[model samples]
Target: MVTAPFNWRPHSRGRIADDGHGSAVGPQQAVDVEAARAARRRLVIDRSCRVPCLVLFCSAVVWLLAGTLLAMIASFKLHEPRFLADFAPLTFGRIRPAHLNVVAYGWAFNAALASLLWIKCRLAATPLRGGALVLAGAGLWNVGVLLGTLAILTGRGHSTAWLEFPVPAAAMLYGGFALVAIAAVLSLAARRVRRLYVSQWYLLGALLWFPWCFTVAFILLMPAPVGGVTESAIGGWYTRNLIGLWFSAVGVAIIYYLLPKLTGRPLYSHQLALLGFWALAVCYPWTGMRHLIAGPLPAWAITVSIAASVMLLIPLLAVTLNFHKTIRGRYRLVGPSPTLRFIVFAAVCYLLVGGQGVLLALRSVNEVFSLTHTIIGHAHLGMYGFFTMAMFGAMYYIIPRLTGREWASVGLIRIHFWCVGLGLALMVGVLTAGGIIQGLELNRAAAPLGHYIDEHGLSEGVGAFLSQLQVRGGAVDFLDVTRGTIPWLELRTLSGMMLLAGHIAFAVLVGLNVAGHSPPRPGPMLLSAAGRGRPLE
Candidate 1:
């Protein structure tokens, strides 16, 4: 006797029962019809944001290629300082910093922005209101990156590690970021959905935190300092928190969004997620002091930092358990979903990197290893292994939807994964070993510092030996200890080459997919068990 709503349509099987006068759709059929319409509306909202996202991604991939080349040059220059020493711009000192800045600002930040914008729109269930603003913001960001990179190469760098952009360039970058952040804020405010998802919390947190960290770091490191030791303390704080608050926040947001969707399950525990978020916010900001453990900061500051670093385990374990439970029986999805595979890999790296941070913060360990290449290995683990991999996974999932086509070649995807994975492992493993050798040798009281310079006479070998001994740490036989790092450095260079090739393949694949080379398909472009066949999801 009751009729379904006016917009209701019968699902398959013509299940609607007819009253004596007219056909009436069932209640379940009406619900299904509404759900289907909602999904289509969401798709439309996402498509509306596609153009700006594409511009950001395209620019990001170009920067990725450039950064990998610079990394290769810097890695090789470590062992062979004169390899390109003739060119001032390509020298190890200049090229190394340039590589770091380009990858972080140009590639990683831009990539994160693209992913953030798309995901935010999806979760808010709203179309982007200011598409032109997003595109213009991306354009200005690229301009700032270009100007900063050129300044660094031209020897006008700020001399800070990640904040090396000159003042003018930094101003430009800050302005660009403000515009992008505003777009995110407006989109979130105008959300049609009432409840905020976990991913939205992370996206908002990162967008807010990055500018705060950047501005604080700039004030502390750029202009005149309060004191020499205070400057160092602030710089260390900014550097450490930048990785945790900005990069890790964005990376984890992507994982949260993709994992549930990929596994066809909701998050395991909302309370656990809330716990993780609050714990990280309260604990991660102060943990930066751990980086200055052996430096001239107050003991209380160092102790607080170390404690915060160790306490991070609470959130780390909480998030790790939440994700594991969500993906409990869906391991097979890793094969069919590149997004799941990369997110899982990034999750594992998060555990490794966080545990490593706790270990490296202890005074007993810090005394010997603080100055060694171990620090370099750890930095890469967080930046490249964890954050970058998460972004790559997000891109794989997002691009196909935006382009309305599958990937160009499944084979290239496998190649890119293995290349980046194996290369990062090799580089990290080798550097860790070399750092241990250098640390143990440098702490040996049997050999004095003066003896190294007196015997070796400031030649290239002697310079390397003394440099390691003086800062990074060395042993009784300075030459022997310094020589131990050479093989590792060479291996690192080889790994960098692998990374370069992998990035090139990724760029080409992205370009092809965007250009509509791949035939349109309903399901995802996924590799099979053997990692060669195309298996639809």
Candidate 2:
């Protein structure tokens, strides 16, 4: 059956994902084919890993584009309410969060899962077992994502940031996962190799973390059972874990895989990798409290949380040192090979975000940083800069194996890398700068005035500046704005006529923040655009 399943390839481009004629290969050549199949199968797959990877890749790209479109709409809404005010469902409030969810859950995660499946198989040294079940699970998961995302678009979504899906959709997604878990367990147990490597540990940790995080968050925050602020606390807890337990786990897995692959040697410090893993798991749970610091939560909760957040430096330093140490003489590979380049980018981003997280946890820092775009900026650094970059590297590494061709063209890869990467870079810069100016103004208990406001407002003023900066080619200099916002608060007037920009920002932010109707007033929006509607803090 295993051998027969693979025969569907060769002449068909999409054959790996299908299964039909494979049941009829003659017995003689079949043995010869089987021998070679086993050889290639060592690379992983019963039917073929690439087939599922391709499908997943499509799903992810679509979601990302969808999310981007949503964001652009949201940006417009902020600046011109009447632009789409006629369509209540298309409001910035709705589309922004929806886009955020789609990208985070659908785009980034689906890509991660595609890569994770590849790594999981390689680490286990096993061909996939329940191909049917996995296909079903993945399909159902997509269905759930589509329905849930549409729900958000139609304004039927529950108001949870990372956990926005209503019960039925969430159940479908989780239910699909249960099948995959079953398949994974069966496949692992049946593996030809049993080295019990550390990468597998990270993958397993991620697998476990998803359900645990989702379940806990659901019980505490789902509409049918919204437990008030307690649920809110739990929901916050889920977001942190999604980073620590889910995305972080996959990130660690990528590091473990890519480090050895790029250097052409086993990991230089397996012991260090293991140490990082356990430390993260043990410490991550406590770190969520840092987000709630001075947020009407208990003092002990915030203090311990802050302590845990600060302690993350241990993993950050250890992982950074390990990655660089391994890459000491291989820096050239980063430029020559897209895979290595992305891996290097993601690793550095992880360190930057991790270190920044520790800093933000500080009482002085969080005091000024909380409830502003500064926090949002930090979140994106972790999400896009760290996690998304790793995911892209993973895709570059995995696609050829699945596509059975060298990506049709390196030009496409380069195009995507530049467009997507540059876009994100621009976004991080503008937001960071706007955040800093806003933070400073906010912390001072007042907004900035004439000259400074004109130079840095994110609405018509800042938006115009950014638009002009785009023409000037010196935009990245503004990234300091994003980072600086962490040290203070910022707010301004209330004319209520918010200036909107491109839709991309709105969708992404909304998806990121959809945890709970986003606090209605959002403790964090802005002074330049959205601020026109509400009084300043």
Candidate 3:
């Protein structure tokens, strides 16, 4: 078992009666010294990671903006298919997957890798190892994403959900990820702090879990293709694991680190954190197959998946309680600290989304929501509502330290938060409500169609079947179902625009901060007017 570092000490401000030099150090003086040493150590770590982290972050922002545009296009096309009908590359089919790949691999992965590097270095109390390798990896990874996105747009992309990237692009991503993984491992091995923080456990798990999932998915789907229902099962497994095991792991790690650091509170319980981590690791892999509920998969497989999804509540509650107790009386800090605000919001989303996921995994719920906009909304709630928000908070905290400058405008930060928050809420709400309507209509339509297929046998053509479906009383028409969702799709497009606005504001803020448009901050840049001049910790 790992042991705590000998030098680890609780934050204290007690006076020392005597020093080894035969002098007395007052309480305030001792506190200042300790703070200074901590600051210096953080500076060294940040400086060591500055170039690579900045590169990764900047690339992430670019991809974020690009993906946001793609999302807007795709969202608009859903309600108005003829909007970009003339352009083959701008079709909904291509744009949607391109947006997904760009956001997932381009924005999310880069930001996550940057966070991993900096957080690992700080947790280990060591300067980043293999910074050059990390930089090179960033280059390769971004290029791969760009190539993959282009391939998707140009119609050469695969139909796989997350692995839409071509083989060459996937290979590049794997190589680049391997290089950074090596750096992360090296940093961990060279850690000055022998005891690992809770964040370290999660970061390391994410770093390891992603590669295993990605490689296995790649091998099964690409080099030696699986057939029939097995392919769909594997795809579902990969998609679920990518979100639950990989992205959520990194998101949770950031939350665990940022909450206590920003709030100046010790974690409520170390035991809770451990319990949450292990519970998540053990349960999330099995939970992926729940996505295949009501599909061709076996009853036992779906049953096992649903059970594992329910088990996720263990970690979900553990994390929620740990965070809630840690910030029990420090709610005031959430107003003043951008990092705290975004992270706290994300922490809450984690609970909501986790619970929703369990509900979705149930066969009864899955039957209604399957293949509807509801699933799309849920995915966004997890990806953007939780993971992206956490990443935003992390970048807000890390960017200032790297650039020695604070965010340029508090107004823009507020705009970013509200736009994203309101937009996502609206989007998810409408899609869910609309999806239920659509699902009910489709389910109603299915009965007559199934009856016709049963009576007419396989010889009846689609034309005859559809003609018969039209005359059947009480049968909901497919066009009516499509029309019913149009308004919700329109609202979703509007929400996408709002989200795009927020992303643009964020991009501009990052630009100003990195370009040193704002005066150098004396300490962390808190969001509140009163706290602007105050130093954190």
Candidate with top TM-score is 3
| TM-score of candidate 1 against the unseen true structure | 0.87
Considering TM-score, where higher is better, how would the candidates rank from best to worst? Answer: 3, 1, 2
Residue 15 lDDT (model 1): 17
lDDT by residue (tens digit), candidate 3, 76-146 = 88988899889999999999999999999999999999998988887787789999999889999999999
Clashes of each: 3, 35, 0
Ranking by lDDT: 3, 1, 2
In the range 266-321, model 1's lDDT, one tens digit per residue, is 56777888899989999999887887788888899999998898899988888888
Q: Which parts of model 3 are misplaced by more than 4 Å?
A: 1-29, 444-475, 530-537
TM-score-better candidate, 1 vs 2: 1
In candidate 1, which residue pairs clash? 441-474, 441-475, 442-474
How far in Å is the alpha carbon of 506 misplaced in model 1?
Answer: 0.8
Question: Which segments of candidate 1 are over 4 A away from where they belong?
Answer: 1-31, 223-227, 445-477, 529-537
Tell me how candidate 1 scores on lDDT: 0.79
How close is every model to the real structure, measured as TM-score?
0.87, 0.76, 0.90
Task: State the lDDT of candidate 2 residue by residue for 364-433, as single tens digits.
Answer: 8788668766677687778877888788777656655554333333444455556556655555555565
